[model samples]
Target chain A: MERTPVLRSEWLKIRTLRSLPGALLALFAATVAFSALAGVSEASDPGFDPLFASLSGVIPGQIAAVSFGAMAVSSEFHQGALRLSLAAVPRRGRWFAAKAAVIAAPALLVGLGAALAALLAARAGLGRAAGGLSTGEQVRGVVGCGLYLMLMALFAAGIAALLRSGVATLSLLVPFILVVSFVIGDATGTLADFLPDKAGQLVLRETYDGTLGPWSGLAVTALWTAAALLAGAWRLCRRDA
Target chain B: MTSIDVRDLTKEFGGRRAVDRLTFRVHPGRVTGFLGPNGAGKSTTMRLVLGLDRPTAGSATIGGRPYPALREPLRHVGALLDAQAAHGSRTARDHLRVLAASNRIPDRRVDEVLQETGLASVARRRVRTYSLGMRQRLGIAAALLGDPEVVMLDEPSNGLDPEGIVWIRTLLRRLAGEGRTVLVSSHLMNETASFADHLVVLGRGRLLADTPVRDFIHARVRPRVRIRTTDPVALTSVLARHGHDAQEHADGHWTVDGARLDDIGRVACAAGLPLLELAAEEGTLEQAYFDLTGAETEFTAQHQEA
Candidate 1:
């Protein structure tokens, strides 16, 4: 039928689910809490950017965003929920699109709120130290961080669809985002910038020496999310529920 | 008008064929029992019909269109593949709401089904806390959210208590009485016999019999007469002479297969044998089903007599 009804149904599912909303709350808490901590601390490094530092909490907080996306899709795989979902919607593509849309909408909304709160919390501590920041730079950092978190959540969601297991998606992603992205960046300079997480996080920086611009970095991450989602949809159409 | 039509439907997993060229039609206004032993592909066939699984060959349709091709399919066919399919953390009300919203069904219908299934009292509780029977009621509620013309349930009575079983039986009968195409699958022949007017028997992923329930029983099982006599010796010898082999039971009653009650009475009267009781023994669905699928059972135990 019409896609609107299916999208509404998916939104209801997310609202009713405690864990899905809980993940968003955790995202907000982690981003604000970490950014506030960063704001209170003084960094001696000459290269530190105050705007980036204010939103740096997202580095760890993005994990919650990834979880929100993964768990939302993975719940369908548990206890034959996918069968019920498919039976209700029947059109596999329509149902999946609705699911992805619901995931992206909430992630982006919460990401934006978290980014704004973190910036405000951290700026309180930076005081004169953050005076060099312009309104445009601060706005970009906040907005970009929000979009960055949403992309990460969608990226995790796409991978979750392909694997059809939330735990597997989390296991692969949690470590890669936590360890490999950093280690690889230190070992291989520009190449690590191409990875989905590293590329997307570039938006949160006020100044960057990377080849990609803020929006272009986010675009690279979007491409990765799209590829993962395409793979997921292919598997959904090809495999029996 | 919405009937399930499955034609030459086939599904294979890996090298093993789960459903083999199965063909059957369940008409509106009747309860068609999809009967088979475990691993007989009853579930697989249902999955194919619902478009939950793709058919390796052939097609299944409802109202002249494939399941996925139908817009707002839940309003055309409501199915309960697994009673536990609802997410455990969501309340029963929310679970039905999700399905209702998907089909653009009114929210009032969700409460109606919950009340119909006697789950309204527990509608606010999380499904994880529900007993199996309660979960089954919730599943039924979800299925009826759209008030679809065709209702399909697989092994719905598995975890229900006797009262719950009776409830489902009445519900299925009422659904069929309302002219809906009702398809219910169960491994137990006797259970299906209670509510099913038509039988679609399957064995080893193949159609065994598709006929009226009464005809299915009468055509497969031999009609027999049970005779209780004061003089067993005389009755036996007389029937033996008349070309009827009488088998004696432990209950002191003699049974003569392929013999009518009237024929037995005549022989007893002509021979002047005292007949305490002479009646046609009722053929049970269990016996008829066993006779039909006995050979098709995947794992058959040695006969008790053997």
Candidate 2:
């Protein structure tokens, strides 16, 4: 099969499922609702960072994106469609690459949308409730938030590829993103900044500190995503489907 | 000719052997029936042949190449291992469409297969709403979408009604008639009796019989002359005297093997044994299968004792 055709086939397989729309809706709703709420609450604090508050929606919204990524690959195993897929493109590496590319497209689009919506909602809500973020800081936060969400989605896609089970991927990822980040952040104090979510969130901060700057934090998250994807690719290629 | 060839193939899961030293050849222009009971390494062998499962030893090739080596695998070999494994939300047409896209099969060919498989009416319906038989048909349609040179179906008749079974039989025969290699796996011998010209019977991960269907049947199935007589014991004795193997059934009927109707009549007349009914009973494929696998049957006697 031609590369373009394989990609098209994988895209159709990913999009045809009802779960994709459901997951995308969940991501949108969570980002909008949480960012709006965070923006309003943080408006009263004196040292509140409007940029960070605006991007706060990503904390919860990424779970939806993670689910989307997980289901993209896991659905094949669940439905036994992987057999058909393998029958068509027997070259495992090419098939995996096609699937990865197709999955990344939606993840990137949905993640960007969620990140943009959250940033905008938080900015409007916080600006009206208290004071608006400075123009430069606001732009940095919005851009960083978009990149952060995309990286988070890719990270989840890697995890999904490794686990190859929707429930297992969700179970493992939810705690790491939600609970572990808090536990490590509270216990390690300054050291916790290196955690995946914490390090990645540094990009959302309006004021850039020498410690874990915006671009650097985004790079950290990208590195994590890259490492996970490499591991997943290795596992996928070596293991029997 | 397009064919599937396995040479000393072996697959091991942990310490247990799933398929051990398995070797077989399925040639084109004939429907090769793969027969085995449940857990007899049938699916494992197929997985190995398709390169879905790695072999611990040996190799399986299709059309002289491994499955993973084919540029367009579906065009070379179409396989349906599971029928109800498709996404429940996708429509039948979409399911086939996605698979067809992999091989660049035209949209018109998709519709043709749907029409051919009688799934055109329900083509737009979600697969979740389909019955098992309908799903089987859809799976077959998906397999045929590429118009592959070799088609392998694992238990295609499974979950089919009588009419569906007949339809599948005809379809397989037609595919083989077109000179494509058609390999169908079934536990039930009767299902493949009329359609399969060549038979590959496996028992406990070992090849029991690999020969023509007719030859296997004739060698394994014992034809009996069913005789109804007023004096069953007398007829049995008379048949035994002629060196024929005869047994008196519980229903007071006599069944004599290795003897024709003429021999039975002659023996009966000489012994003055009155025969009410005498006819040769043609053995079915099921009986032939039982005789072939009778020694290897692990549960029959246990069930009888139970």
lDDT of each: 0.91, 0.81
DockQ of 2: 0.73
lDDT of 1 by residue, A120-228 (tens): 9999998888888899988888889989998899889889999999999999999999999988865647778889998888788778876888889989999999999
CAPRI rating of model 2: medium
Q: Which regions of candidate 2 fall more than 4 Å away from where they truly are?
A: A128-136, A188-191, A208-211, B228-237, B297-301
What lDDT tens digits, residue by residue, belong to model 1 across residues B105-177? 9889998999999998999999999998898888888878889999999988989999999999999999999
Report lDDT (Cα) of residue B141, candidate 1.
80
Clashing pairs in 2: A79-B85
Q: Candidate 1 at B274: error in angstroms? A: 10
